[model samples]
Target: MDCMFKKIAKQGGDIQFDDVETIIGPSVKLEGEFQSKGNVMVSGVLIGKLETSENVRIETNAQIEGDITAREAIIAGNVHGNIIIAQHLSLLSSAKITGDITAGSIAIQQGAQMNGKCSMVATVEPKPADVKQNAASVMQDTTELL
Candidate 1:
């Protein structure tokens, strides 16, 4: 295993490339939507949306020019679109990201560069009904005081 894999293991996660169902080789260039239910690894250039139910790995020298949605991701290349990771995201030192990110958890190395918004998926937003109930309760209490 490489240092990146070791780091992931230390963080209590495992990504096995041996089981990867899709691989975009370094010399290949793709220009359309790519969807997969299993793991996907990219070592080339992709210019469209990437959606995967399993993990996605972007290796060094790779570049992606569209949005990505995955259960987890490890990025060591360049990405120019939004990234949504349902579980976790790891940005290695070589990563250069230029769009928003939404992830349940994220880990960025010291040299990783990012230039957009980041939202945590673990945050809980109150439902509209709940907010309305709380507001009404507050109004009732104020009226009682009056």
Candidate 2:
């Protein structure tokens, strides 16, 4: 887990996978909107809108079939929908986005792919939370996913 954030020092490395409140595992396939106030990390298939007030990380093997709205995002997978970020967004080399993008700032790696229009918006500030809570204690519908 520590190795994953080594290259993401810019966001202050404040959000980690282990500290995520909602995690969609690689083998799980979910079909519903994901709304949360806390950070989320998806490594599987999500077939609905995802909105959050915090950071989001979409892993290399993940696949998203709907729009994503978040404060910030780190994507390294395939996204079939639009993305809107309040702050910075990083699209790794393995990322493949097929929809429009709206973000305050963006970093695209050499091999990243995005096939739609992009717009930059004004971002006031960014402040990721420092508190971490166990996923098991989270009462969200997607918690403790099997």
Candidate 3:
């Protein structure tokens, strides 16, 4: 295991890929969506979505041009679309992301550059009742001030 994987695993992430089922090498350039049930390691360029039930690792030289959905993700490259991780998302110093992120939890290194909104999956959804109650409370406060 590399230092990056070790760090992610230590942080309670699902990034242990002892049995990687998919590997996109650095020289490879793929298009279209990629889906898998097991661990995926990408060191190439992918021009479409990536969906996996297990961990997805994007290496330093890798680049992804579309969204990513995974159980967990460790990114050390460039990503141009949204990322949704069910467990955790770790962005290394070399990572550069340009889209929104929704994750259970996230860790970003000092030099990582991310330019989008980030929301925790557990808190992103607003309950209808809460919204209605908030609106009612605001209306009541306004009426009292008038």
Candidate 4:
């Protein structure tokens, strides 16, 4: 597991043939919650939640029916559930996603399909005071215009 994560961390952001801690083959079907401490690669069908501490890769023939939570992900398959990624996410040309996505950053290749909204998350949140100040300034500007 440690070796797999080291490979994931050392590699560039592109999803390549990195070391995998878990691999689900094309003939297998998995149900129930799947958790991993390292990288996961799936080429099969999954019907439950997937949570990974590192990266996740879904191959072109894969199909997933539940939510996915990962630090980073690359999808080249069919997914019918929401995805939450803490870092980078890439949807390849063959990917089809049917649910909303939340990620720190995302890249969608040509021919990729998505039916739901995508929201980008920031690594650092603004301070409450900063938000309040911005809102107050905006309100003041509007009032002056009125």
Q: For each candidate, what is the lDDT?
A: 0.87, 0.83, 0.87, 0.85
Worst 10 residues of 3 by lDDT: 1-10
Please report how far candidate 4 places residue 146 from its true position, in Å. 48
- Model 2, position 70, has a per-residue lDDT of 91
- Tens digits of lDDT, candidate 2, 1-146: 55544335445344344457788889989999889998788889999999999889999999999999998899999999989898888899999999989898888999999999988879633222422233334645366564
Q: For residues 69-88, write the lDDT of model 4, one tens digit per residue.
A: 98889888999999988888
lDDT of 4 at 142: 100
- lDDT over C-alpha atoms for residue 109 of model 4: 88
Give the Cα error of residue 103 in candidate 1, in Å. 0.1
Candidate 4 structure lDDT: 0.85
lDDT score of residue 59 within candidate 4:
85
Q: Name the TM-score of candidate 3.
A: 0.78
